[model samples]
Target: MRLSTRYLVPLIALFACSSPTTSTPAINSSAGPAGTSVSSPSSLPELAADPREPFLAKAVASLLSEDHLLQRKIDDQVSREAFPKYLEQLDGGKLFLLKEHVAALEADIDHLDDQIEAGDLVLARRGAALLAKRREVVAKVVADVLSKPFDFTKAETLETDAEKRTYAATEDELRDRWRAVLKLQVLERVEQLEELSDALAKKKPTDEDAPARPPEEIPPTFEGKEAKARKELAVRFETRFTRWKDMEPLEPAEMFLNAVASVYDPHTQYLAPAEKENFDIQISGTLEGIGAALGEEDHFIVVRELIPGGASWQQGKLEAGDLILAVAQQGEQPVDITDMPIDKVVKLIRGPKDTTVTLTVKKPDGRVETISIKRDVIKIEASYARGAVLNLGKGHEPMGYIYLPGFYGDTRGASKAPERNATDDVRKLLEVFQKRKLNGVIIDLRGNGGGLLGHARDITGLFIETGPVVQAHAADKKVEVLEDTDPGVAYNGQVVVMVDRFSASASEILAGALQDYQRAIIVGTGPTHGKGTVQALVDLDKLRANPQAASAADSLGVLKLTIQQYFRVDGESTQWRGVVPDVVLPDPASYVDSGERSLFHSIPWSSIAPQPYKVSKHSWTAAQLAEASKKRIDSQPVFKKVEAFSKALKARRDDTVVDLKRDDWVAERKRNKAELDTLDPKLSETKPRVEVTPLEESAAEKTAPKTAGDKNVKKRIDKWREELGRDPWVEESLLVLEDMKKLK
Candidate 1:
């Protein structure tokens, strides 16, 4: 469960100069126009309200009713369903609000539909007020609990899973709950400090100049470590509370509207202005910003990774794991962002090209420095398709390996011809593979969350000699079979497509089509992410009744409306049940309950009439390969350990009640770490089974650097090749390809 404010943002000005009109049909509502008068609930507490929210809500409701895949009405039933969803977005962990507060909110649950229909945000306003009150109370409770030392010897347990617990019956119960939660936080921090201390103590000096750590430098006592943890946790909570208090009314309103949208399906959503812009950047694989991927950790905006050849990477000052403390324009005072929302922080940092933005960041080692970076157009090279050549040491042929992070396309460019896209990139790689005459190819789609549907179709065509790729079933009961009419295959070699639970949407389309046509063997831990539904970005600005009120409508945001459900060429819909792979691998991800099936209000699986298609001549029987793979897996020590690790993970996930006692917690952490170590041995410790190398042309490009950006590009490619060489999955794919060669 994610908070509503998480989606609210003005991240970048990349596409701010242009507002591309969506193809989604505009909705005309009978509920008057923008700024129409609606009766407000006098009983509800007064809170700042955005004038554009009512119009946005009205437009969203109209669009969903008219164009949603399910064509479900926004009635009393939807209202009842939305109420709990709204609550979940507000207080997902069941931490802030008490049982009495939930009971009070539930009073207007049945009439929520009426409120939305009337363009009145009575429920959202009331809920926001209640949440604000609870947040202040919770903050105080957290501070009070962390002030005193906890009894580490007491054999107490804490129910960590939010779903398994209910709202606290009373304020006293809530206080006790916070006590346990804070103790767990402090205990985990203490364990981390102890581990660091131990690692430092055991370190060996490499040279005479290398200074050894003094005995006095290490914190010897557990009590001191506990005190440090508590102090840090107090600051973390203080920052969190400050951020929550600063949240705008639009954020809650967006959450409330999304609850209404989600009643139809999980994919159907309302994208706030900033969120829509972010979505565009993701699909296009480009952004004009600082070029650093930021993530919120303990309410602090931390730089996760720097895009190669990006502004931040070129600056050479910002590093991954650096916590941004403040933002300042050129010659401006630094604005403190201690607990600011990540989106808001991004808004301050992202600007026009050649603009200088100063960021005050705290390094991992606690060094604080202010660095200025000139914002530029950042092309996310990692998001595009890239390939490498893989070989098994002796008496084995080299196979082509391509990893596509997403089915990306330049959406911001003219529709007639995009500057760069996934299909073109993959096609170029295939051409190189064809030139080399590689016996087989492995397309790794693991952890790919999908992108453009058209790109998925085009890429699938690159592998096969043209066929029906997927079927789209619309709200009007129309079945449209999307086919790849292209006449020739790019590289018709023995193909192996790797997937995991995270591979979804466009990823599912390609994998499922290849599997259905018998063009490739799908190998994964389990079924792919079953997000079969298609969503269209409906610009709410275009749905306004009065076109002259352009200024008012511009800020209305966008609705990501679910319009259709896609199915495999074999007629089976990858909705609740995703595409199951031919070969199952022992992976910890398989044990986790996730994907479309785990999502609330997810559409049920359905099938249509199978499309006409011819099976590939190069097809190998999956059963035979499965049998061979199973035999190898059963004998392999690594796979055996993987199986044990998966089971242990499943057991841990099932049992959320954890021991809060410091000693017990430490023991459990050690056991978990030991399991992880066995599953993921150090890269240096493990011998590489498969050797990965760049293609001849790619190697030449790496040596001939025309600019500093080219050097960074080479570094990225080299890093990719090294990581691929160490991958167990890639090794397995190599062996599988070898088996295919023999079978052929």
Candidate 2:
């Protein structure tokens, strides 16, 4: 829980955005009342007709702002060393309030923009002041977040009016108790700077070689040396803050509105008009670009996957694993877009059809090259599919593995019954597993970015007999329990749920429920994503159409706000802590930064009422799980090799930059490869040729399954089977399940 200045700060930078280009408007109005008091939606700015897109856009923009971006960068530099304590002081309730404020502000901006576009300057200025007021609120909250110290005594948080009063009182008490913690951090840093100066001031060589005192034990002196050291430390903070201030300025209303929406949940956000339109276009499969999905990877703009028929893929020069280093339009110089936000990069990359864009790509092998491609529509078929299975190693021990990448179904078509959704797909997989008499089932929820909430609950029901799956807390502090109501327990024998850093939101809920019930063994990287919050899609357009503020763009318009927080049965928060695994595994993803700690304005870990149920003790306790993992780590050569590889990578991460000397870089890489080859020779082999066995019908049970054709249902099923068969994580999960069996 101790914060480290050196290792913690840079990682957070990955999530924070640069500063704004324009000056934020100052608030002349008196500040809103500080204590817990909910403002009526009618009293806020108008929401747009389709607000989710705008909210998402604006949220992304705000997250990329200078203050947030710098903080995240610093966090990453420290590799989560300081995060626990850093998150402790955050106000969960205030977080919701802030997000609501942001959403309202975004609505105002959206309205003013609409008015301006329609030649209404009078309305635009009115929107302008609301923007100013919103900024003031945001600035204060940001300051508060940085200044506050965490209180461990506030165990249960308020989600209702009475609870808020109690919660506020508890926080006040804890805040007073822990105020010294913040002061101590500053005192400690200053002490370190002073000690270093003292060492320098000593003239004797032997004295210089003397052991330095730990940061805390050094006494504060009144000498000029102490004064100089303090001044130097101040310079450091100034430099860090200046780096934050250099980024782009968000339009006044945008920052205020998005910050408000974020308080509800990390995912709920305000979108600028441009960002909203682009996201819609992307969802409709109409984006013109290289045809790849992108997201923040540490501080880099990484390509998540490629559309098979997209311009980038068709050219075949670019692969799914390549990282985009820079992007340049036809007439502009190539901009070094490394560490830039995904949406901004997307904006730069996307354009009209046939427009040429040049990209600098970096391969996993460290080879760098440039490619020029024309923009075009690309279908993203690989992101989601059906028929994934769990393999019990090479023997096909009949453990079903299903990968639900996202809860996806085209809800657009009128005749499309939503019943044929992710849950349905899973039910079919279960049926197949049951018929095959599978020994157990492994659900690979790893890398699922989340989608429909209903699908997630239904999916949990497939494994658990029945129970309350998750509890959601809204603005009024009312708790709504989402239950797993399905009576059918399909292939419930020996379930193992595999999750990693990217398994989030709905995925976290499902994993948490299964773990809470001991219905499944949760195994994977250290923790699942800590996104235990919900979002309400507010329509800013609708708000603007109201007569009360018809001309007040600032008052009547924008935001998709987050209005709730969620809790697990144990009353432990998943906001920043995430769900810890029963058995931990090594993953390449651990080498890169991801998850809640990597995001800006993420809600701090807090808890609510526990579900009226108890977790069944795991067949093996935490100690036993750890011992078994140790045995496996020592016995399995592959595991050891991966660990060693990680250590070497971490050493590299310790370096700030790399030399581009071709021969030297090549030699170093060669040496590293040789070392890796010795550890796990299989890693050097070509990508494994994954041959999926076609669904077999025993000659004894010759029943032909019904097929729905032209809909591509059968084809989709086959493709899913192929993907599941090839999944390495699924294979790894089966290994862990076998380990669990032995330990039991």
Candidate 3:
């Protein structure tokens, strides 16, 4: 998780900045009007306290009430085949609550039915009153949570007594303890609520008039004015919340945590129980699916990343930013799952292997297209691999470039084959560098999301003989220094490491280790992903089966416990402090609102003990790198044009207009296209053509701008033209290599 110390300065400065002038006038004139209902912020309801008790309590109650009304309907429409393999991960506590809560509501439902049948108006009214009261309790709990936002930094000071004690423990144990707390107390509760809802839905009533119809029947379709229309449409649908609907409310921040927690460790997961079964099945390596990593970007269910060689990627039909408007199973009605949780949407898309799922996609160019894909298992062979060339420069000099996608392995069944380990691959790659008498090597770790820790250390050992690589610090304050035991430099030639934001964890470690030794010149974006902690997952199935033997809170499925946080040789924690590049380069992501710091509830930056060691300074200093970059950029045409385009792009994104009209939208799209087209003749000429129409053309048109900003488009086209001229960063890096050749 990304962490930052930038916020810490604000707290310290708050007192310094406080003054009579800084204090704004109160809403009330001279102690406010007598009986104003404006309560102080302190009087707000306590949402964090016992959230599990109330949150789950409401979910349990809702599922129970809905189940009685819709059980029969579900049993009829959805077959047993749709039922998940829930046996493996059910928590006894959660299951018990589900059973008791549903049964209690069912009893009430029966009494209501009888009263309605007998025309007992008084009794029926009384029963309705009771149900309403129960619902009020649920609503109040949710309202309390929604009233105030959560801040992760604020939570750091709110750790319980138990956490303090655990934090004082040994490194290995401390990391595990912190992870367990997050999994059990934070994630487990959310999962249980989702599972409970699905389980209780096994029984649904078929009577349409009894519960009234859901708003989805006349789905929220905004055909005008982007902002106003969405607001109005949302309000209209929300008004029908009183009635039973096959819908669940998902908090973005909470769900983001669940998705990211798993990333800390391969095995640890925090899936809402609805997705538990699907996640498990996928992990086993045999699942039918549109192999795509889906996520919500500004309320749209967007395709974040495509699994290489998957149906979508191979077809070249599905683009990374395309928004899925609708999903239609072969014989069923289309489901508009827009604004739905990612996991729930996955359920509708995935099925038995080879099943055809139709996707209605909205492309960035405002074109919509329908594509059918048969789900299949994504092969391991598809992930990037290792190989190398002996000759780097046929005429100028002998150098090599090695691309390392990531330090990956089949963790479920780690391949012992030497080819699977990145270290092994790199080792062989170095052999080529040596054999070819190369002058330098570029280790490309651009999009590598780190894998095994052992590989990180082993890879570092290949560069330097024997010294500390990275240090580990536990919450308990224990420090462990990791050293390169292999006292041999496999390839000691001038080295350059290339990275970007996607390069994280093990990638950071390798880069940091090399930088510490002054062994390589790190080149790329400002910083790598600031994920430095290691996590271990505790399988919930095993925990629940033997509750007595397991830890007190072990039944919350797999807990990806953060076991240790990494530190550089100089003692700087990489948690929030990523590996800063020696030479910063132009990155489009920086111009856009994207990066580790943009995420919610990221951890805070912290530090620990530094390893005692020093390395001889390389010939290039920070100032020299800057001077070279400036000179190279001045001479390069491509970088200058890109810089200009990036500025305009940033301005447009920052000042986005929410219009409502097809004509305006068309105009805006054309305007943007025109600007991008003018950047460079070659660049504009390279633009791809649109073959499909947008899914919601009318809706998009409503949100389009009335006046086309053709000037902006023209500028953009010119910028692209300039980009064809040259690339300064690449040129500067090449120059750096050339300089290093002189040093050797």
Top candidate, metric TM-score:
1
Stretches off by above 4 angstroms in model 1 are 1-50, 195-225, 273-340, 345-383, 410-418, 548-554, 678-684, 698-707
lDDT of 2 by residue, 1-744 (tens): 111223222322212222222233332333353322224323443212221234333333333231231223212322122222112212222321243433433343324223222332222222334333333443443345334333323332222111132222233443432232223323333444554557645645444233333333344553433344344334443443333333222233343344433432356555443344334443333235777666544446666655544667555577545688777787454565654545677789988877778887765544455667778655343343334334444554545566566775545457855334677666777778778776666777777767778877888888766678888775456788888776677665677888888788878888888888887778887888787766443333333224244222222123344556778766666777788888787775455556788776577887777877645444756556556665665775556667777666555444423323334434565686676556542442424333444333322113223333223334444644554554554555676666666656
Candidate achieving the largest lDDT: 1
How many residue pairs clash in all the candidates, one count each? 0, 79, 42
The whole-model lDDT of each prediction reads 0.74, 0.52, 0.48
RMSD of 3: 21.4
CA error at residue 216 for candidate 2, angstroms: 64
Evaluated at residue 592, the lDDT of candidate 3 is: 45
TM-score of each: 0.79, 0.56, 0.56
Tens-digit lDDT string for candidate 3 (1-744): 111223222221122211111111111122222222213322211112111222322322222223211112212112121111111111111211122222322333323222222323222222222223333333333333333322222222223222123112232343333333332222222322333344335535453111122223322322212233223323332442233123212121123223223222322234333343434444332223877767655445777556644656545577666789777786454466655655567788887666777776875544455667777655433344433332213344545656676675434334553345567767767766677687787787876777778888999999887888899865446788888888777787888888887678889999998888888888886788788776443333232334347332212222334546788887786766688888777764455433455544345567666777658456666556556766776776666667666675665555423232334534665687688666532433333221111112122122223333333333332332233123334345655666666655
**For model 2, what is the alpha-carbon lDDT of residue 120?**
29
lDDT ranking, best first? 1, 2, 3
Poorest 10 consecutive residues of model 2 by lDDT?
82-91
Instruction: Give Cα distance to truth, residue 324, candidate 1, Å.
Output: 13
| Candidate 3, superposed: residue stretches over 4 Å from native | 1-244, 247-272, 277-291, 296-300, 308-323, 328-334, 347-379, 388-395, 410-419, 538-563, 614-618, 680-732
Give each prediction's root-mean-square deviation over alpha carbons: 8.6, 18.5, 21.4
Q: Model 2: how far is 333 from its true place, Å?
A: 9.4
